[model samples]
Target: MTELDEPASAGPAVQLALRELGILLDKRVWAPGSRLPGERALAGQLGVSRSSLRQALAMLESEGRVHASAQRGWYVTTSVVSEPPSILKSFTDNARERGLVPTGRVLHRRVRPAAYEESRRLRIAPAAEVLEIARVRGLDTVPVCFETTVLVRARAAGLESVDLTDRSLFATLEEVAGVRVLRSAYSAHADAADAEAARLLGIPVGSPVLVGEEITSDQEDTPVLLCRSVYRGDAYRFEATLHRSPD
Candidate 1:
C-alpha cells in the first residue's frame, strides 16, 4: 500500500496511539530504556482497548520505536528526532512541542574578557567583556547534553540576573535583549565523550557522543551567540529533511 493509504487501514485507536507515541518519542518524553506506563494505565490514558494498544505497540516495536521486556513491560528504544530542519527552535521549545519538559542547570556563568576565539566568532574587539555560561541540559529526567554558550557582553545586557534553570537561552535573549535568532551556522560530528561530558550525561567515559558547534545570528545577520554542545549519542537522534535542487 502507498504511504497515504496505510494510515487509513489502521483502526482509529491504533492510529491515535501511534500518533501519541510518535509525539512522545519526538519530544523525548521517553528516553531510551525508559519503561512505558503499564498496559492498563496506558490504555486508559489513550482511551483505547487493550487489544488495540497491543496492536499499535506491536507495530511500533516492529519499527524499532519500542520494545517489550518479558514481564517487565514496554520501553522506548531510542529518542526520536527532536527538531525539524525547516524550523529553528530552542531546546526548551523542541521538548515542549513533543510533550516533554525541558530543564537546565547552570554549572557556571561568568563575565570575563573574551578570548581570541570568542572575540573572533562574535566579531568584537579582543579582550572585550563577554558572558559565558555552561549548562547541563535535559528532557524530563534524562540527561542528554552539556552546553557552553558565549555572548558578547554588550548584546547580553540584563542577562546576568535572569534565571536559566527553567528557561532557554534563546528565549531569554529575545525577551531581555530584543535579539531574534534568524539563523545559525552549525556543524556536528561524532566523538568520544570526555570525562566532564560523560559525568554530566551519566555515561561512561569515552562513550560515543555527538559534538556540535554553532554560531547564531540575529535578524540582521549580526552574530549573537556561540555555542558548543555535546549530546549523549544513545539517547538522542538527529534528523534533517533533504531537498533536491531544481534543475
Candidate 2:
C-alpha cells in the first residue's frame, strides 16, 4: 500500500516530523507550490507513520500554510499572506480579530472635577464635571496598556449607570448608548514608565513606554473620546505606511 494509504500513529514520531518540518521552513527547503512527498513516502523517509505526517501538516495549516481543499491535496502557500490583525470592524466586533483580546479592569468611572489636562482635552472649564475612567487593558491575557480616559460629563450623561469592564468602551458608546465616535486625532510620544504604568503593564519602573493621546469626535465634529494610553514597549508594535516627499 502507498504512504497515502498507510495507517496512522502518534507521539515522538509526530514531534520529530514536526521538528524536521520547521527546519525545512527555516531553510525554505521546499519552494512555493512544492508538493511535499506523498504521506507514505514522507512517513517511510522520516521513519514515522503516515498518520503522523498528516497530523504535522494539520498543524502547519493552522499556522497559515498548507492549504487543503476538498479534492486537492495540501499545497504550500503561493502568496504572501499573514494573519490580518484584529480590527474594529464594528463597535460590537471583537478585538481578537487583530490578535488582541480586549479585557480591562475598570479602576474609576465617575463624574468629578476635570484635571487641568482633561479640561483642555475635553474642552471643558477647569474643574468642570467630567467622567474619569482608568483601566488596564490586556491582549491575549498579557497586559499591554494602561488608559486614563476622560469625557465631558455633560455630553455623556447617564454614564454613571453604564458598566465599563471587560468590554469595548467605543462599542458601548456607539452601539449600546447611541453615541457616535466619528474620528480621532492621536499624538504619540516615548516616555519612561511611571510606577502605575509599570505595575499595570508588568514592566519595570522607568522602562521605555509609548504614550499616546487621542481626541475623538462625532459626525458633527463634536469631540468625544479624549484619553491617554500608555502601551508597554516590549509587547506592542504599531506599524504605519507613509509617503515621503522628494528632496
lDDT of each residue in 47-97, candidate 1, tens digit only: 776677788899999988888767668877644435567677888888898
Q: What local distance difference test score does each model get?
A: 0.82, 0.68
Q: Candidate 1: deviation at residue 43, Å?
A: 25
Write down the worst ten-residue block by lDDT for model 2. 79-88
Model 1 stretches astray by more than 4 angstroms = 1-78
Which residue pairs come into collision in candidate 2? 3-40, 85-98, 86-97, 86-98
Top candidate (TM-score)? 1
Best by lDDT: 1
Q: Give the per-residue lDDT of model 2 (tens digit) for 1-247.
A: 5545445565676788888877876676665444566666677878767788878878887886665544446655432212123322321143465544566788877778988877787777899987788988765455667888887777776666787777777767766556777677766788999988877776668867878777877777887768888876544444444668997
Record all residue pairs in model 1 with backbone atoms less than 3 Å apart, i.e. clashing: none
